[model samples]
Target: MQVKHGFIGFGNLAKAVYQGLKEEEEIEFAYFARSRKEADIPYYGRMEDLTAFADVIWLMVKPQDLSAVLEQLKTCDRAGKTIVSPAAGRNIAFIERYLGKEQLVVRIMPNLAMAYRKSVTAFATNQPENENATEIFGLLGKLGKAVQLEENGFDLFTAVFGSGPAFILSFIQIFKEKMQEFNLPGPLLDELLLELTQGTTLYFAQNQKKHSIEELIRNITSKGGTTQAGLDYFRTHEIGKHFEGILDAARKRSEEMSKNGD
Candidate 1:
């Protein structure tokens, strides 16, 4: 039998999930949103209609918009439907507060890389053994690295997995900005940066099994070389600790959202 997946909000994350799974066999898609989006799938204006149509419902609204969406969801006949949420900082317990403990709530932390099936996702569910929840977990395996984790781990997971891509890109931007002395066009500079990142990633992929990350760095750093000079400054300025603060800030915000229900 085909599984019907309904999105409660057709935002970027919802679209990424759709793009990731649309070509899969025996899966149907639909969505309910306050405003109609550009997607080609069937649109349900009413939450009741969407709730009735889907076997699995993805709650795709923002964390701040989650409460209002849940208020509408509570009025719908949601029996036999699995609820999946990717909203950062929100936990299964916060969802259960509206739909109750019996409803299977799957919480996931995934980045926009979901569209490319390369996302590193963190998964947790209110019901671990339930076949439906397990099925959802298996479905996540198709998207990327899906690790089952406790709810308490979600804040760090969100900071690292969900927000990590942007942080990496921000660092890349620093390199791009510094390379303006080359007088290269912006697009060419971006392309060069892409090659650099891809090449570095490929090198890591090829040698990661044999070498630790520190060993990998040491391999690139010759004695008193340019790379060594940069590394010296990086350590002296505690740049790594400053970068860690970015992750810490994201995690703290997630915890605050959980406590404040936002």
Candidate 2:
């Protein structure tokens, strides 16, 4: 049987997911949003119509918009449907309050890498054993590395994986800024940075099983070398602790959102 997938909001994350999954033969995609978007899939003018047509409903709206969307969703006849939400800060219990305890609600934290099918996704659900929910969990695996986690673990997951890309790119930006001293064109600098990152990733992929990350760094560093000088400065200034503070701030915001529900 074909699985009908409906999205409540067709924003960037929703578009990334659709792009990642649209090639699957068994999934039929459609969406409803305030404004119609350019896409090959069907667009429903009404939320009720979307709910009725789909077997799985994706609540793809922002965290702030989730409550209003749920208020409308509660009015729809959602029996036998699965609710999948990727909105950060919102938990399964928050969803259950409106949809009731029996609804199969899947909460996920997937980065924007879903567009490239390389997302590291975190999954949690109210009904772990339900056949449809299990299938949804399996589907997440197709998109990327999906790990089932406790709801309480979601904040940290959001900090590391959900918001990780931006943090990583920020580090790359620092490199780019440093390279400006060479007077290279901005676009050329960006291309060089991309290649550097790709090469580093390839190296890690090749040797990760045999070497710990610390071991990999040690292999690159030599006695009284440039890498060692950088490492010494990094450690001496507690830069790693400062980076952890960034993640902690993001996690704290997620916790606050859970409490505020908006």
lDDT of each: 0.93, 0.95
Q: Give lDDT tens digits, candidate 2, residues 6-92.
A: 999998999999999989999999999988999889999999999999999999999999999999999999999999999999999
* Model 2 root mean square deviation, Cα atoms: 0.9
Candidate 1 per-residue lDDT over residues 77-153, each given as its tens digit: 99889999998878888899999999999999998888989899999988888999999888888888899999899
Best by lDDT: 2
Mind sharing the TM-score for model 1? 0.98
TM-scores, one per candidate = 0.98, 0.98
